[model samples]
Target: MTSPLFGQMMDVPLLASSLLSHAARHFGDTEIVSRRIEGDIHRYTWRDCEKRAKQLSQALIGLGVQPGERIGTLAWNGYRHLECYFGVTGMGAVCHTINPRLFPDQVAFIVNHADDEYVAFDMTFATLVDIIAPQCPNVKGWIALGDETCISTHLADMATPALSYETLIGRCDGDYPWPVLDERSASFLCYTSGTTGNPKGALYTHRSTVLHAFAASLPDAMGCSARDAILPVVPMFHVNAWGIPHAAPLVGAKLVLPGNCLDGKALYELMEAEGVTFSAGVPTVWLGLLNYMKQAGVRFNTLKRTVIGGSACPPAMLRSFEDEYGVEVIHAWGMTEMSPLGTLAKLTWRQQQLTPDEQRHLREKQGHVMFGVDMKVVGDDGQELPWDGTSFGDLHVRGPWVIDRYFRKDDSPLIDGWFPTGDVATIDADGFMHITDRSKDVIKSGGEWISSIDLENVMMSHPQVAEAACIACSHPKWTERPLVVVVLRPGATVTREELLAFYDGKVAKWWKPDDVVFADELPHTATGKLQKLRLRELYREHVLPTVDEKVV
Candidate 1:
């Protein structure tokens, strides 16, 4: 007989309401801070926010926004957006967050697709709303999340009445009991970027979200606590800032909100001013900060550790922070399915004895799977590969919080009970998983897989390159070719030939980019992954020399 799930017998439903409110009841005085417009900072306590969120929930209900209604927010990370994280969901409704970074059409499509009844937006996104509101017919209303003094210069055409977020909250009655919520009911709907296809929604259950917060708080995961002041530089719309909003108050940690300004000088200023001890964001955000620090001659005095995800953290980026700046970048890997946290790259006790250089090398891998996560690499014949770190195969994973299926999509991706993460990986003798390449992003040039990530990481190590992205283009002989697009650092100069020369001795010449394209900036997805498919389309016509290129 199979063993029962440990908490299966428990009757109490773990809801986000319970998580946010419980902390407010006990840890009421804890601070949640945000840097607002014109560099002004605003602050609110957990108790204050919980009380307001409850009031807002009541106000929303009074607006005939019934239970199970879909409410959306188009604001950056702030006290108001954090309030709605609880307010909408706590009222027995679904909180839908739209990534402002998505194309206007995409933003409109998701809002209409989700049938969001209402939208609350920031003033800074007035132009974004003007473009999106008319396209989303189901969205009956738009409320601007700003003070009365802020002008809606770009929002004249929409019929929806734009009310200030403050006005709505001010109308709320501060005392309201959050209804007892069903654990399986949809609390939030997060859409996966349509890089592979159309963005689909993931309906997070009350139980899954609360439990995931607990799992994320563990030492091996984010290791978050009350002692830390956290700045979730990650967008709040993305998996609820990768679950930081819920996790931060779990221990009543002081929360710092960055409010959409992710530039290095701004983030460094916020971290220093807020005394932020920990933060999490995509690798690009940190990479910008690293470059900005080099030019500005600034330092991150308060930040001790960071969680790098959304893309692989280049070894150079990791070493620059850990070795030079005294900050640790814990590489975490996951997709929208696993509540998106499948792995955290932390060195084991034995590995600590390795020299710093060796540690940086090991840290480049995705690290071992976390406690609740079970992973195995399978060959073409369906046999599990040994953990020798050399043999590569398709990576298959299974876990509770991981998505078995995308909401409202039919042609099933799940084979049996296991979900194929669409990643190619290798398991080593030490039990660490080194991701060889993304299954889709993997280049099959002459029947051999070339990792675009590995190639990009190597090129990023070049001092003149600010960022690099590798994409596969069409090839006549090999059937596919790798072309690298590089973003040169400002004031630094390098030619395509120089970059190819840099790779001559390091990797097989054939593995080098068939041709390097220079871009002032690389195209990025809404979630920050390089939009390689676009690059592939942009450069498919130019063919690289095959026979003359050094294959050895």
Candidate 2:
């Protein structure tokens, strides 16, 4: 038997606090700009953030917060919330970010489920905190993420008197040291949108978070660096702004937090003024920004690249940004379970050499996996499918950042150690993944599957269509057929027949929508995903128009 030899490398635990410490030491002067909820622009540096984070840790420790305790935050993206992110996690306590957009009942349920001791909320969410406070009995107290004036002005009428965030940190000196702990300890906790039942929590460890940050900053990923000014339009309450809050500090990029103001004009002006070189957000957000730019007849001065995730990016939106605005669009896909970053649609050298039209078509798919993630498509029989770009199946992924099980659940959600993504997709031989439809949303007609995403994307490409959703409606003969619900652009008009005919030659005749209905707007989840489940229920009993038997 051969003896195994160990390398003489030092043993060190990967910690989230070290990211902040490194930024503070190496890029102390790097700026962290924010549009505060207080209706003002706030600016600071990594050194200043580190000092305040230390003070916040001291204040949390003084409040009797112990290791592994959950410290909840119901705040927007800003300097104060960023401080809490590092401060709570750095002190060995779990930083639980509660999405304010969730229903009051869901918020309360998450608070109780996580057993959070203290919840620090922005003044913007003061009323929300007041509503949920009575339901979360285990929570010791609520801390307002504001100063004395803010609390007196905003939280004065609340049933529970909240402590001022500034006051708590003000009482402590900035001399606290972060404790060293096992890297596997939980550092952050985030709950799903809970569209069905009670929301479940995905607990993240220090090691996983740090590794995710490193991977996210890679050249082919978000490509964070000290020279870039990055704005995360995604809220801090959502997957820690898709890990920008950590990845930004890790690379010393000038962090720009867009506080409650997510409108097109606000985001566009902020990006122009800050000279943001890179940004990441969902497709719905970019839609607003593109509409604003087109209407305003303006152009970006320094904005270059954007990562569109949270949902699929429409081909039209990608073309508009890349062709018209000269901005590179990196279409990305991920879920909350995998630290929210799995694939990004950046063209490789070989793919880039193709014709521009071919490149555009290829860019529509979710790109190759990040270095840490391993994924495969499996058929109903649990057999792995080939990556031939035609064998659509359930997507399964396993990675260090991916969750093994829900936070307090006993049973595991993994199948053979791979977490099923609930998405129906095709992976090309080149390793690119294209999501055809969510498993629950796929339309089945006459024993054949129709991708609702494909129909919706094609409908959205129409000049007059503002937004579209495809749902499975019952058919008299085909069992279930595709029904499209469309929202038209303002002051634009298009007949249902014309829109339905527009799909000619674009997709298979059988895959074309059987009916089209106009809606003022489509439903979206709290995180901006299409609420197809709700749409399906609303259109479950919808009747399709009688058509020629041969045409059908």
Candidate 3:
């Protein structure tokens, strides 16, 4: 009898510091571009990023920030904020990214809940810091991401101890090495955009953050690499900007950050200036870009692929990108609970062999899950459903990067060891997932369910329609009927009956929205998801004419 010995390897921790160090050593010359809020472009290198990040780490340590303490950042996507990401996490403190788009109350609530010891912000959020400072008693100090003049001019007379980020880093030579940290230690914190009640925090560990970055960098996911120039239109406060801040540096991708200016013209000019090859954002942002380009008869000089998530991407938007701009739209789906990367709509070779229309249909679905993640659907009885492409159910997933529980909460959100995604979806035999609607947003008419997302997508496909949302309207006979609220593009016009007629042979007759209402704009959440609850409240008493009246 013989015994076998296992192979041994070095036991190095996968800390966030490793990503920055790898970039600094391997791709130091790569340029990191940023469109600053002060109406100018900021440029630096990864080598400089590492040195400044280390200096910021020294600054934090000098400010009495202890390991495991929460350090909050209220800034846009820029070099300084990026430095904070590595500096705080590398020094073993939790980097809490606060969403400035959130209400002042929610901002204060999140900071107090995380018990942040220090806060770093951009000039754009100087007013916000002043407003929330009185509410957050635990925040002891504030660091504005700028020089002395900028800080004094932009962020003046703060209640707490205040200073400029440049001044803080200037005092140190940046030679302080990063501390050795446990892989399982908390590294970052991001609060969900409270759809139900108060927002809940998702505390991420170094192990989870690194693993998520690795998974997202794969070719099947975000396809990040060193040669690509990435523009993250998505906010850093939103699920770590869908984990791009980590994935980009892990591969040394050039970063083009749009700071506080996301309008189509601003984004297009920045992308043109930086030669952004890849970008990520919600559908609304892409819509703005598409409209701006279409109006100007301009083409993307180098932008190639875009990852659309936070909400579903309409098929019209996909076609516009591919047909007009030659940009491949990667339809993605995720939530705050999943470290915000679950599935990306990448077509398989076999599916790509199909006709263009057929392939477009497949691309409309949220593609398969990336490696390290698994998903299944559950029926109303809490039983798992089949992957027949027709059996729609509640989508549930579990993965290495997924959250098991909310920060500081006692209850576990997992059911049978899987996190319920609150999305009603169907996983086909080929493994493509089509999300029909949110569990709460589905329209129930005469005991049959209808997908509001499907209706909205159909409506947005109209050339004149800029945005659309379908919600269940109160009805007398049918109990509930789908009503479409739409926003027409400027200089375009369409009648309600004309719009209704446009849906004639597309979807099921019953699934068609019974009525249409046009507005100047549709309300959206901070993350750019359609604010259906607010729409429902706005039109709670809306009633559809009887079917007999329609027959007349």
Candidate 4:
């Protein structure tokens, strides 16, 4: 046969232009809405968003934000941050998203370390700025995002050239001519939550991030489309809200943003008013809505689906939404290294015939890999394990969007072609991947596996439990045991016996925590993750369970 390699090599542009361009081209008139603090609805379109992104690029350049220079944003998910995301990356500058949930000191550290020339933030973070601004020495410009009238004036001694959001964009010519960008050029940088150590930057290239957005938009993945109105409850700062904004628009989905108003009433109100069909967030955020539903009805007739990630999703939460509210929670798992999307729990057609209860059981697993993702589980000895689901081992994955290597650090997690996800997982015969725990977070009790997260999930299922954390405390007889630290709902309480009984027949009896302690509130990391390690340290000395307690 004639050499087909001579056929013209397919050439596709690497810039994020694909996502925005597709939306602006076909879905120009589709609505992209944002809910406001004063309970107002703001509506625009893809073309409007594209125009704003271009204008913002011109605005940044006008304000001395030259291409290739780093710009930072400590903001919420809304049209403004969306503009900054594409505009900054499109202009050939690196957009660094600072997790506002990060401690003020860590925020200052990241900004200064990235040598950010400018910072744009939503109105709600004015106080957060007050604490971190003094330390971000390289930030030369501060643009308070929103209408000029809404910006606060309690500025302290922080020295930075200030500009109003509207004024900045208005100063620029609406049309922006972007430079040709290489796929390898750094597009954006998102730091890990640094729960285990100092936060490190994961530099994303135009090629990697663009491909990830496309992968995320796939039907088996987020399954986003223009007809779908998505509310990404996850913060814009966290892995680009798990890449929802980037991918949702590309898939032609209407994005409804709840800016800085993530509480239950705020979220439910936005979801209700916007007619949101899909939403995504960590389990903690949704738990609030569940609580709110009990107090005031949760009418989510329009909301049929939501993606739950950034920690394990309680099976009970999944079953409750499916049973009560008629919503499906897609439990996903991934990390910063994988562009933060590894798996999604959507079932195949063959499994549809399964009973609802059986389906719920399967849906609790992490999920099968998306189209381009390849996965495996290996032992500590670096040997591959069978995907029998019952076999426990460390999980590994490799994909186009997976981290080739850390941005500046040397020790790589990749061996051969795979990147160790640092999560322990098991894959059943049907290919459903179940994450047992983060390799670092696993608890070895009497040489038996005791999933801290599973116990925590079961704990949070209790009506009186607003939130819960289960951590491994050192045990004399068993090298480790689960300690349940709980945050109770206001005006609700359950005795220890009552709470433990909630898990009866639900989980193996041995997996139950030896003791339970109630707390006014659980400690959270900057990214809103329960600080489980801290909880373990706090309760380390309390040896309430005797060796013979198992029999009792």
* Each prediction's whole-model lDDT (CA): 0.84, 0.91, 0.90, 0.82
**Candidate 2 deviant stretches above 4 angstroms:** 1-3, 547-552
The candidate, 1 or 2, that scores higher on TM-score is 2
lDDT of 4 at 349: 96
Instruction: List, residue by residue over 1-552, the lDDT tens digit for candidate 4.
Output: 786666687776688756787788888988888765334677899989888888888887777787678899988787888888988988889999999887788889888878899999876677788778788767787888766555435333334445787788877766776667888888888898888767888888888887888888888888888789999998889988888878876778888988777788888877888789999999878888887886896577699999998888887788888889989788998888888898999899988889987888888888888877899999879898997878989888998777877766788768878987778888998899998887777889888887777787788778778788888877777878777888887888579878877888978877777778888888877766777777777886877665556532
Ranking by lDDT: 2, 3, 1, 4
Off by over 4 Å in 1: 1-10, 37-39, 151-160, 381-383, 508-510, 547-550
Residues 1-552, candidate 1: write the lDDT tens digits: 999778657577778899888879888888888877535788889999999899889878877898888999888999889889999999899999889888888888888888898898877787788878778877767878766655344345545568767777788778898788888888888888877656888778888788788888889789999899999999998878988999998878999999878899889988999899999989888888888888888888889999999988888898899878999888988877877788888888999999988887888988877777788888878788888887888998887677767777776677667788888999888878888888888999889888888899899999898899988877767877788889998888788899988887777766877778888788888888888778777776766765355444
Which segments of model 4 are wrong by more than 4 Å? 1-6, 36-40, 152-161, 501-504, 547-552
**What are the C-alpha RMSDs, in order, of all predicted structures?**
2.6, 1.2, 1.9, 2.5
> Which candidate gets the maximum TM-score versus the true structure?
2
Each model's TM-score?
A: 0.94, 0.98, 0.97, 0.94
Better of 3 and 4 by lDDT: 3
What residue pairs are clashing in model 3?
A: none
Model 2 TM: 0.98
Clashing pairs in 1: 387-428, 387-429, 388-428, 388-429, 389-427, 389-428
lDDT of 3 by residue, 1-552 (tens): 688987699889989999999999999999999888777899999999999999989998999989999999998888889999999999999999988888899899999999999999887777788899999877888888899887667656655457778999999999978888899999999999986689999999999999999999999899999989999999998889999989988999998899989999999999998889999999989889888998888999899999999999999999999998899999999989888899998988898899999988988999999998999999999999999988999999999889999999999999999999999999999999999999999998888899999999989999889999999987766778899999998888689999999889998888888899988888888889999999999998776765444421
